[model samples]
Target: MDRRIDGLRVLACLMVVLLHVSSSHIHEFGPKWWSANVWDGLSRACVPLFFMLSGSTLLGRSESLTDFFRKRALRILPPLLLWSCFYLWWLWHNNAPTGNWLLAILRGPTMFHLWYFYAIAGLYLFMPVMRRFYQYSTQQEKIFFLVTWFLVASVYPTVQSLYTDVQCGRAGLLGDVYQLQYFGGYLGYLVLGAYLAERRIAWQKGAALFAVSSVGTILLTYWLSKRLGMPCEFFHLYLTPLVVLAAAGAFIAFLGQPAAPSSAGLQWLSGCTLGVYGLHPFVIDRLLISRGWMNSTGWVWIDPLIGTAAVFLVSLAVIGAIRLIKPLRWMV
Candidate 1:
């Protein structure tokens, strides 16, 4: 196992927790909103980093479809179902309206964060085929595929977004030139992850470039949202060019660093990440904020920092306790 990747997982999970903590207080006007914006924008790379790590580790592995399905199911399905039921009960307890239970289950669990499980499940179904493609393709062929995906998926749509009159879903010129729609999406990130991990590209000065770009991306997002009086969420999207660059840069940066000495503490915390992820939203939305434990307190930075740390530590303790149980251990 790559301890660097394990370390990255811990970082990504913490970013997600902080992102949610920041998101909860984002609606406040003035300084509070600005503080939340900084945290949210900086953490935009969290999910994309997750996908990239998946590609790095899982894409080239040798496994039969049946075996892959069985393994993935064992890892993901129990938690999905367990959390789905838990959230449904949570919703009912809060008197939150659920329009359709069946549809919600099909889409994701009752909580918004659980949608990643559904997306990963879909990705796992096609991963074996993708691995075969990776195995057979030449360097030029791989580059061609990534370039096409970048243009069609990332650049074109962002350019089109500048023109408000341009309606989405209409493919326009690029769509007519080739069947580009089928080739676009998160698949690129999978290939990208594998490509980056396999090749030892010398990213000289890349860290500085990435830092500059990330700062610019965050500032642009904030400025645009304020100017337009609407959420400039596209800038923060996982598939967007800026976010893709930020995530890729971060991955490479981590990969270049020397691995730390193995620590049982680190490994245990890393193992608890998925459980912490599943449970933190509840802690943030229900317990911390709802119980008045997290509040403005007139200190923008201090409040969110304390809240995030509290949520992470509490969730970690709960997950740690759950892991000690034999039968219930798999659910997390």
Candidate 2:
């Protein structure tokens, strides 16, 4: 039986929704417009949850490497290629690119942002060995990974900011590690997730830890963004720290309780989550966040809540519709 981790999945996907919805510049005529720093901090944990969950679920050694690669390839590449094509069509319709059609299709799509597909695909390809390492890796090795993650994705962001407006300079192991500090950022969180899987951490403690870390990170993020005038770009202290905090919190919250398929609501929510992921961008980008939605009275979060609701509704509809399809039925 699939140990359904849907609650966490739904939560993570919703966090992604929150991030997308909150970051938009849309505003409307409503009183529910205040943004929550808490939510901002909470949402940052979504991607890390995704990566960690994937590691926990898919890292099992029940399949051949060939089987593993094929399954992951089907799951990730199909959507990635399909979305890339969709984005290519979008760009062509907008006359945004007139260059080589194939090349442009490969390189020029908002679908490109779906790079998480690539990242996951890459991670999954190594599931066999990563899982093996989890079984054998020492605590010191784990520390090395987390330390590297901190130096690059977390610390480097602050260091780079001091130079201001400087473009990419020397690219090294450290720089690459610093660039994107999620999913262990260099195997830290991944290992943590695996370790928890191996040890069976308790849920309540994880939840409490999550709560604490999330609060701390958000406070730091706000101070940096509001007072220091620093943008919350990836690798920045505030954002990276927030992401790290969220990632840690997510692991604790998620792994504390083993996700069994016994729960009805969890299965239901998990079924709808993929729908949430695929369909949300359309409404958020097209309707709620279209333009001037951010011009609300003063409250910043009002639009995000409304937008999140709208996206969730669309996601539900999409999920329902997908459930009805014969060929595309697997998406939901």
Candidate 3:
């Protein structure tokens, strides 16, 4: 793995942790709520970055479909199932009615963040076909796919939102006549990741673009939220053009930077990112937020920062302890 990519993973994981930390307080009114909204908007790139990282590493790799499934299942499924069950137990322990454990697990559990695992698993299933498509596609064909994806997936939704009374509901020309369904969703991020990884931009250029898009995304989200008198839905959608630009710029910036010298500690933390991502929400939502640890300090500006660090460290320690058991190490 590229050490820079590893660094990107660590950064994405921390951003995700920060996002959840900030999100927990999003409904609160006043400065803290505004701060949470801004932080949440900034971290919107985290999941898209993960998707792009997947594209960078996974696409164009030559492997038999069976072998790919086996490897991905081993890498993804175990932790997903284990953590899903853990979250279900946590839900029950907190007096949240679980109803049926098996059904909950089948329906992706009550835990919100675990939805990523389910979505990514579906992506893994489709990757073999996507890989073959990439192998056969000419440069122009790839560009066409990306452009079509952006128009249909990113632009169409925003356009539709402009008219409040229109009820397109998957019956529109784009969906029905053009059948734009195939080019939508996180697949764009995946292919965009692979495409960007193969190209290079100057660090200065990348940084400037990233700063502009990131600031634009944050400000736009803030404005929308204020206008609607609630959290903005548009800016946070992963496929939103602003978000795409922000994520792509940040990704390019990271790609342009030279890999830093390997530190054993950093490498270890990077390696543990999957575990951290899988586990951190539990610490944030259940252990800290539920216990009011986040509110105990009453310092709006400082509490989230303190709480985020605490959640990250506690989650890391828990994952580290899980790794100590030989049989369970692979699951985490």
Highest lDDT scorer:
3
Question: Stretches of candidate 2 above 4 Å error?
Answer: 1-4, 25-38, 98-101, 138-144, 147-186, 226-239, 262-265, 291-299
Assess every candidate by TM-score: 0.91, 0.78, 0.92
- CA-lDDT, candidates in order: 0.78, 0.61, 0.80
Candidate 3: misplaced stretches above 4 Å? 165-172, 259-262, 295-297
Error of 2 at 206 (Å): 2.6
Segments of candidate 1 deviating more than 4 angstroms: 25-29, 99-103, 165-177, 201-206, 259-261
Using TM-score, give the best candidate's number: 3
Model 2 TM: 0.78
- Which scores better on TM-score, 1 or 3? 3
Worst 10-residue lDDT window for candidate 3 reads: 162-171
